[model samples]
Target: MSSSNKIQKKTKSIDATKKLAEKIKKQALLKQKELQKSSNQDADADADNSTTHTALSKATSTSPVSSTVDPDAQLKFNTFAELKLVPDLLEAIQQLKYTKPTPIQSEAIPYALEGKDIIGLAVTGSGKTAAFAIPILQSLWHAQTPYFGLILAPTRELAFQIKETFDALGSTMGLRSVCIVGGMDMMDQARDLMRKPHIIVATPGRIMDHLEHTKGFNLKNMKYLVMDEADRLLDMDFGPVLDKILKVIPAKRTTYLFSATMTNKIEKLQRASLNNPVKVSVSTKYQTADNLIQSMMLVNDGYKNTILIHLLNEFMGKSTIVFTRTVAHAQRTALLARILGFNAVPLHGQLSQAQRLGSLNKFKSGTVNILVATDVAARGLDIPSVDLVINYDVPTDSKSYIHRVGRTARAGRSGKSISLITQYDLEMYLRIEQALDKKLPKEDKPAREILDALHIHVDKATAEAIRQTKEIHDKRGNGRRRKNYDDDREEK
Candidate 1:
């Protein structure tokens, strides 16, 4: 009986040990999840809380006369609903699921609805599209006025997006907006123009082509002029063409300029193009979307690839867009990433239109997880949700950075922008920060120990490199490592 009791006690001891091991494993998993939550770039830590009112709602709160010398002076808006939009327009807004007005809406819509000139400094996706789009629809509603509204966009992609937004809002109304942009069907656009659309959303180059090629293209009744991305347009050589178009346009017409940033170029164009106009900006300083958390990484040219590899190892499964400075850089980065077994793709202007569209569609659908792109594909792109924007190359200037980072942190969703700065980019980095007027936090390189923990597999060449590096360090005996493994191996 004593022996049997002793055996039972030993068995119980084994059982307790097993239970303790299981408990420890579960605890480790929970801690890992917590660590991941803390480390994720887009951890739902912030969101865009600034879009108070949609365009018309935003517009109505402003005073007609300047209350102060500052253009940002607050104006009184009774409400955007006071703009007296057609019932069908309201229904369309409701169908699009917009319940209330944006700030720009409250301020600009009332004046615009009254057929007054306006200036809008709202950010992209701040419902600026709808701010002008709604007014355009309201102004053209049941009007006998010719050439309903003329709105110019900076990029073909943006032109198409604006037309799409309009289509959704005008589904119930008797209005049609034709898109005129580069790279697709000019003759077809000429044919579209023959229909005499109440509104024309066009890129400058294509519109100029239509003006040069198509006869009887009169702006006799063109009552409204809108520059969707005013700053970008004036920044490009589109200035001369736009200036000429403005000359042909009816001088007495009302005008509106909407841009993410109002650069000096925009100011020059505004003075040249817009009369005493109403201006509104969401924030005094142009920033990454309110929801985006921006950080910076410093690397040498040779280290960029290894750092990116390490980042991917850590960020496993998240969608990321890396913005390179040129098409060749985009192509090379995409290929290198793919060769490294990353789900990567290249999207740039160098591809045929079909190819560009195809790559975008694949990335959007999650077939390809990472996209290396130039600014051409970056504008007016609204993916379902972008997890990160990496400036593989720091932008030429702050405006470029704004547009690139704007690719993420859209609507009310959260995102992040990481600038990869190489030694060569030092000067450009300072300029970018100077333009931004905000200091970027420098993040330490990710923990290499974590890479080992995750069992990351590097190329044979890379592995050989790491081995040689450790050997040299071990020889130096700087005490970073625990011991000189090479010496130990030799003694063995």
Candidate 2:
């Protein structure tokens, strides 16, 4: 072709792309307006007009139900029984006391049951697991086959949580599911695979290991594939691994990809994985649940710990999660809390698999009311009773901030999140506010005498925590060195 012709063709292609982009933008705006109108109607009908105040001065609040319900299909069906679910599944849901479906479930379940690929966009704790699991289980009831579905999660805790949901929902149906993730016994997982369970919930890396090494454990016949927390999965650099998995799974399978936000990366993955998928998005942008009371405290760097202790004491007897940026900080904070006479536990990646699960169990069972954790516990682990979330360190990004605070105010429950902002965190905190499109209310500072009194106990606890942490590190180092020395001596 002539050079002029080539230039004309390129210009035409660019114009076409611009038109498509504009079309999508217009559609999104329409959806946003519709959702907003519906929310207003619901609020007018069922909202409580009372005000509640806590130790913190009057904080901003909204109706919890308004934030979670998507008017699409939700107004049509009010209960699980109205959704035309199978009798056995309906019985299980009723027994579990799940009366209503959240917006995600209300919208996605119908399309999923129709055997179409889906792209679900909702914040964390919006009942996404059941949205996908119900359709898969309903289909499995008709066709009982092993290795029928594969669910991938960004973290091990989320993968296990998804498996728990499957087990609970499918209890009456004799459904079999297995969770495969890193930091566990591969040989044991291999043995479980030998049993040929119906569903496999796993993190990307470990499942890839099994696919490569475990004989007779291929997803050749898998019918349903779910990528939960798809953005986080790719953010953790699982793109290449996911590409390989996609190539191996059958092309005709139903795929459901769920995420809190849609970046360029998520868009690309959606195109590559889902086939003509129906998109169901209940949230507009980076948004927290309306029931979540968010506030921040600007503190001096030296007084962050003292202020954190003060907040914890004020919220005593409430189930809480204290989020830190680093594993070391999480460990130290939990140690400090315990020393100060609070029942606390730490959850982070550095602990063994058993230890991590133990920490989660303790917090869930109310054996410990406070859990100090890194972002590992942020995304999709649902403990519905979580009443408070404390950001001991401001998250580096807005997305992490959304997930960290999402730990509370789940499933239409009222909860609170407080971010402890220091001088160094001001810039990042501002960025988070920009993303949320709203300013968080500044928490009233406690009396100076209150902090001064707590400082004495905090100082002693901090010193003791540092000493204990150092001793633990030394013991681990000595154990490693001793093993190496013994190996060398044996070789000699």
CA shift at 350, candidate 2, in angstroms? Answer: 0.2
lDDT of 1 at 306: 69
Per-residue lDDT of 1-492 in model 2, one digit per residue for the tens? 999999999999999999999999999999999999999987865544432234223454322112234634435456888767778888899888988888888877878888988888887788999989999999999989999999999887888899999999999999999999877788999999999999999888788889999988899999999999888887776878899999999998999988877677877887788776888888866988988999999999898899999999999999999999987899899999999999999997767667889999999999999999999898989999999999999989999999999999999999999999999999999999999988999999899998999898898999999888777657768665465333222111
lDDT for residue 264 in candidate 1, whole number 0-100? 76
- The lDDT for every candidate, in the order shown, is 0.73, 0.86
Model 2 TM-score (2 dp): 0.83
Q: Which stretches of candidate 1 lie over 4 Å from their true place?
A: 1-83, 144-146, 364-367, 449-492
In Å, residue 428's CA in model 1 sits off its true spot by 1.5
**What TM-score would every model get versus the actual structure?**
0.73, 0.83
Candidate 2: residue pairs that collide: none
Q: What is candidate 1's lDDT per residue for 1-492, written digit by digit as tens?
A: 699999999999999999999999999999998888887634443322234335556677554443112324444444444556788888888788776566566666777777677767655445678888887887677674557788898765667778888888888887777988665666787888988887888877778778778977877788888887777777766778888788888888889887777777866776687776766656444655667888999886766766777776566788899898976578767766776788988886545445676888789899988988988765666674788888988887877888788877776688888889999999999998887788899978866675454334444434554555455445645552233222111111
**Whole-model lDDT, model 2:** 0.86
Deviation from native of the Cα of residue 81 in model 2, angstroms: 2.1
**Candidate 1 TM-score versus the reference:** 0.73
